[model samples]
Target: MGSCASGTQVPKSTLRSGSRNPPFSTRPDLNLNTPWARSRSSWREEEPVTKPSRKLVGKCFCGAVRYEVADEFVYAANCHCSNCRRTTGSAFKPFAGIEREKFRLTTGDDRLLIFGEESGHDAHCGHCGSLLYSVVREGAYVHVAMGTLVDDPSIRPTAHIFVGSKAKWFTVTDDLPQYKGHVT
Candidate 1:
């Protein structure tokens, strides 16, 4: 676990209240600090814009990492890449791509373990190790783990990506288009 702090999550009331900003402040860009807990210059920050009337909520398996996301999605796909399979323990990982600003960590920001903390990385629960989402497109978008979402989103996987590297034993029965590589 990459967690250096306790897994306890701050309440919504105590956290920064607004539509554009998430309650948590570990992100380096936001620069908002919880005087009692976190400070500036911590982990990465996801850019969230204005709030919407409806939002989707998701959490890790152990209920340690909780988040809220805007219902809008840029794209959604099922990835058959080896890394996606290993992380989700499935033949493919069904994910929804949305802007970073649309997502917020409602609780358990300190409990997140980021893998490949660079241009793109996978955010997992430090405690239960739940694969939550992957920051991609130079950290501009998040391929959110659909399995973690508690509220249904408006989008669904319209295609399969990385089929060339997909598991040999698993068969794709769906009629959705299968791409040998990433969708263009």
Candidate 2:
């Protein structure tokens, strides 16, 4: 994680807000690692600028890293996988997938260092060591780290992945759905 003494603030209008919890699960899951079936170029060119369904704010531990999500998350998920737990040092990781173009770094880009793992990349503040967001794959979408955000993601875990390797201390109660390993 990166560290910094100061942070920047972005306007709130960039994101959307809603209280109703959105569904995070999908009936027919898609492979997360594979390229999005939709053409990237076409999506970028034609993607509508919809208002952010939820407002989410995040910063690094040292206040150096700051960011805002300006669009409603397409999906929010919880992972109990060993790698996620180990990397986050938490029982579970709550993440929201938003379009990469919608994510904005309000400040502290210099402090942001990306640690790429086999599963995903951890984006954090290099100065304060605050974990910001994880980019599962570059140029696709961002997995907003639920813990790092200042505002509630306002979404629920659609499914729990890697349940077979989940730690003993943690238990998922959402009941949305459970996958022993990768669902998509």
Candidate 3:
């Protein structure tokens, strides 16, 4: 036995028996007894859900190239080596290291530039000449240029590396750990 929204008596056969929704007031499918009708709230799934992207986006200075990388990183540093300084034209380079598999070029593959050999190389944006990342550790890892990031990352530079080769014109004022050579 069942009752309609207005308290009118209805035989169980006239209603969708075992339907979980209350006596219908305005729902179109409220009387149907399909799988989705068993749960009163299943109708909410009619629209798809969208989650915010967790990966970080990076791009070249002229926006001619772009990439996406997982927010997770194994290490981060302020690199003061002469090579890094010259490539970036700065006193130091802020970079985050992660497995090469996690770093992907999302756009402008034709304009992508590789500056070194296969085992180790610097990835740059050919159009804007932006230093994007470095493939190191025998090509298993990549050190991403923090300057090219368009999204806030989960990690930040924690130490200064290769300080021995640091330019005399610049002085590190932060209290981060300083490594005389390179990090292992």
Provide the overall lDDT of each model, using Cα atoms, as 2-decimal numbers.
Answer: 0.85, 0.72, 0.88
Model 1: residues with Cα > 4 Å off, grouped in runs: 1-51
- Ranked by TM-score from best down, the candidates are 3, 1, 2
Candidate order by decreasing lDDT: 3, 1, 2
TM-score of each: 0.71, 0.64, 0.72
Local error of candidate 3 at 71, Å? 0.1
Instruction: Judging by TM-score, tell me the better candidate of 1 and 2.
Output: 1
lDDT of 1: 0.85
Q: For model 2, how does the per-residue alpha-carbon lDDT over 35-91 read when each residue is reduced to its tens digit?
A: 664566567879898763565678766788889896478888778888788778888
Reference-based TM-score, model 3: 0.72
lDDT of 3 by residue, 111-146 (tens): 988999988999888888999999999999999999
